[model samples]
Target: MLTRLLACTIAFAAPLAALAQTPPQVSPAVEASAPLEARIGELAQILAGKGDYDAYFAPAFRSQIPKEKFAQINAQIAATAGPMIRIESITPRTPWVADVTIGFRDAIGTVRISVAATEPHQVDGLLFSGLTPRVADMGSVRAAIAALPGRTGFALARLADGAPQMLLADHGDTPLAIGSAFKLVILAELVRAVNAGERRWGDMVTLDGGPLPGGQYMNVPAGTKVTLRELAQKMISISDNSATDILLKHLGRDRVEAMLAVVGIADPKGMTPFPGTLEIFKLKGVPGLADRYLALDPAGRRQFLDGEVARTPIAAISPTLFRDGKPVRIEQLEWFATPTDLIRVMDWLRRNSAAGPGAEVRAILGLNPGIPQPAAAKWKWAGYKGGSEPGVMHMTLLLEGKDGSWYALSSSWNNPAAPVEDVRFAGLVGRAAELAAPQP
Candidate 1:
């Protein structure tokens, strides 16, 4: 639960498309004047793999974004999305600003362009601001998720003041290995503490011990002072394990565990004496330790963690344990949660984060939204935290959809024999978000 993000959502990483994708038969309908038409044609050419990058775009724009780079991005998107199939709409905001909705075989996006007034009207500002997969219906969303390898659990629910209303779910109640997504609980406890006036967000924490060094912190010194705000942000946004451990230690294990009920975890005792990332690493990384720890009751396990696990030097752990690139004692050693638990935790976050000290929680979760644009844009706010390790992957989203409709989608995929496919899972959540949201 304490590791940094293993993989970012693919949409935010880069444009994606499939070779199997083929252009659909449809014609463009240009409601605006010729300026948009010309811009759309050039953009289509790029996606269609026929554009001369240097001659078409403005000199200033090309200077910043090289022809080869743009060409490659277009090629990748085209390869997956196929050629531009249709123009959904074109709206002019000003003489120079306009939005163009372009559709591809499997995806659709709105690119906003800024055109220059001079001859050739060589476009100046161009960006595919948001792109979302085109799912025919909820069946496509479910099928995409079910097609993945290993055990999978997913839940999509509408959240508004009361308990979450499930829209669609597959194996939503089953408990599975949820990696860093467990950080949500840690964040929730921190929010609770800050809200109750037990602690202040601006409190300074000095680094007595940090799992890894980031070349040092805050430009002051190695173990320098950092704010709770900074730690909370890093812990959630980047899933920073070091920050997580620090906050967990600062918050007290019992205090943090107490909030588990507040967040609606069904079996709080299952995760009793919650272990930090370093603790989990030591339990699994140290030879002959997992079995020893697994044999104990919660009290015995907590004692073992504080005693032998804490005393063992980091050097004593075998590097090869993690080097094999396979799941290592994941089912027995890692953090645990169910899809419903994740949604409930997220719902608590959404409801509490509306004001007070919890407000920053919203911004922190939105820091690395995990959702790509257009789909991300559909929601007023998109807060996300994803987790992964060999044989384990999880994604949790808190979305504020149109008309003040709020929702959460959480999923977990675990396969001990091999690495779970993260990109496919990312696409599943993306399509689910598109389907969950009220269409424009």
Candidate 2:
């Protein structure tokens, strides 16, 4: 047994003897060992070739790289990896450990990167892009608004992490009437007309006595030659009824409706002729009669009810004026909108303001471009247009504050049958603006 064991040992020793006896093969090229950093760089290239971009060296190599230079190195890795080396994360695992996780888009799939050192200077993490933090919370804006007595919807958006982000909303996609805010469509069309050479800003419309009081047309002086631009200004800024009617007449209701359709406002029927404009005037002509029968004072509302007229026409008109939130003469006046729909109009107007010359929609009625905002501590700049037809009161505003943030507010009360004296109707919109506008 001993001899057999000896024989086995001899067999194993014979190969060692041959290895010692044989001369070692030598190559013509001889390279010295490189520093750790140089070795890490070499390893990075190898891993990059192997579809492991996160395979960067940890420890001593990581200590050599500055934080600012890391981005450049990461970019270089991506370039070398041909789109497969998606960087996930690069972070320290421990004082002595560095980890890199690499992601490959191709067949090789994913790999984790880990490098450790006895001392400092190590990078350890998964290397890839898309690692920014995001918080998806929109409840705050809603909670703030829900405190109010009425229902209103809103939308908010801002830049976050290099992209447009929607931060708040409630039924924000639904469309509504948007009232005089539709005038912005007229402004846009006028700009288009100027661009097409069909009309110029200086083009004039002669105001005639036939269009005014009886208050059927706006109360402009007879023979007033207002420019198209001036008409647009008054129409939007002060919500002037006469200026709007002239522009509406000159531009044609059908053309304006078509342009509104292009901007995606639903049901562009407000511009069309309706009996309400004339009916309201007829009703306004009646005086003490309307007040006596309606049980109201008649001193202030010269446009609504004349104080001197007899009672017979007042009795005849009161039912028609106060019916079911819907006036008998003009059904379209019953048209009102949602808050979200108003945002769309404001966004459209902002886009219009950003357009180039001949495309500018200049303000005519409200605050001019450079006008200072109101001085009220709570109220800043309130550039707005208001529409009131009985139970319906609509307001659109571009509100800015001391904080330099701007909010576009669109609000309408649909209770045309509800009393305007309810005050809450207007207060609803005011409350919305108060909540939305930034504090002084």
Candidate 3:
């Protein structure tokens, strides 16, 4: 659910009638201010439509953001929440800064807009807050899933019962490619190993120069020593590919598979010898490799993967392969897990939370909260992990509400023809989360 779109500027818009109820912080002087109010209103209309507002931006803002960048940001907003419907209210925070409440087709939120007090009145800053969209009821949530551009599967289940109360299942039980989200499974295995005394949290391991290229620790030279716990932190918090591969190498693939079995993952054979980021790149970079590999039966595919891993050196992989090479057929090259299987993983983590390693794992997962949720403070704790590659997107969350209720929301979307819309999909997930626990 964490995406680049969250960083986009969100401004305020409100109906004129609603301005009377606006916070008293705005003096009558500011409300009656002729040109500034009109200009801000004009800015909102320009943003809602496709009009360019480069002339209205402060010199610093214009220099910091290019025209193309603004276009992309506007396009993302339009795709996710539709055009701004109206401004709900505007509260002046300072002579130059004000908070605006804006309504969108699917959501209502507040944004702080700051304008320089100058002749042209250029906008200097914009920030969003409390932008909670209306939660779709169960039926609407299902309809939305069915309306996605590609195949989609989702489940909302309480961790207490481990059963999906609401589900939009288009082959929901079948495992699909889930990119770095596979690291959750590895983290689970690592926690189990630590709990069993097979490995110590502080145990030091020397990097074999096998760390992959997609994340932090990539710059750490070969043979550098670091603690197992620190490596696990990087692996989950940042989806660090290098940290993951190093841990995978340390633990051996068999143990990871065993952990899957131990946790009762619905389909164990569907993912065996879990391919590290490097291995995935090696197969994906070669033309027709994924198709050929996937065409084989499961055993044959596993054998082929093993053979490829044995032959390929981590150093030989071009760092630019994932960025510049053809998009890998994610349906074949990445991790596979059904929504139910992921729910089971969440259940395991919750049931085991009192254990030392369990607590540690949850702590690490909580390190990155993923997308921001409205009324997040109402939850005792929340942990999230998401994964994406061209044509594949997945997100899973474990939350414990203040009322002692536990819930898990796991969803995935796939389209082999194009990249999934990150912002729109994230909004859907946010709606689903809100439905799971409504604000008091």
lDDT of 1 at 233: 81
Give the winner by lDDT: 1
Q: What ranges in model 3 sit over 4 Å off?
A: 1-70, 85-103, 108-132, 161-171, 295-303, 313-327, 438-440
How far out, in Å, is residue 400 in model 3? 0.7
The ten-residue window of minimal lDDT in model 2 covers: 10-19
**In terms of lDDT, which candidate is stronger, 1 or 3?**
1
**Candidate 1 off by > 4 Å:** 1-134, 210-223
Clashing pairs in 1: 17-80, 17-81, 18-79, 18-80
Candidate 2: which stretches are off by over 4 Å? 1-179, 195-197, 212-222, 267-333, 358-362, 368-382, 400-406, 421-428, 434-440
Per-candidate RMSD, Å: 8.3, 31.7, 8.2
Q: Pick the TM-score winner.
A: 3
**Between candidates 1 and 3, the TM-score winner:** 3
Q: On a 0 to 1 TM-score scale, where does candidate 1 land against the true structure?
A: 0.72
lDDT of 1 by residue, 1-440 (tens): 11212122111222221101111223354244476567766777766657777667889988656777677657545644667888887767555556677888877766667677777877887765445567777788787677777788989999987899988789998888888888888899989988888878899998775343121231234567889999888777666666777788888888888989999898886578798776777777678888899999999998998888888766555656544457787778877889999999999998888898888888788876665455676777778887877778788999987678788999888888886644456655766776678754
Q: What is the descending lDDT order? A: 1, 3, 2
| Each model's lDDT | 0.72, 0.41, 0.65
Model 1 Cα shift for residue 260 (angstroms):
1.0
Q: Write the per-residue lDDT of candidate 2 for residues 1-440, one digit (tens) a residue.
A: 22221111101111101111111233344222223233334444444444233334454434433343354434433432334444443333332222233344321112222334333323343222111111122243245334433334455543222222344556555343334455666666777677677998888888874432121244446887878887776555444545665776688655765676555455444433211222243343334333342343222332232223312242333323332323222233323344555555555555555445453453442333111111112444445555554334455555556676555655444332332321223333444444454545
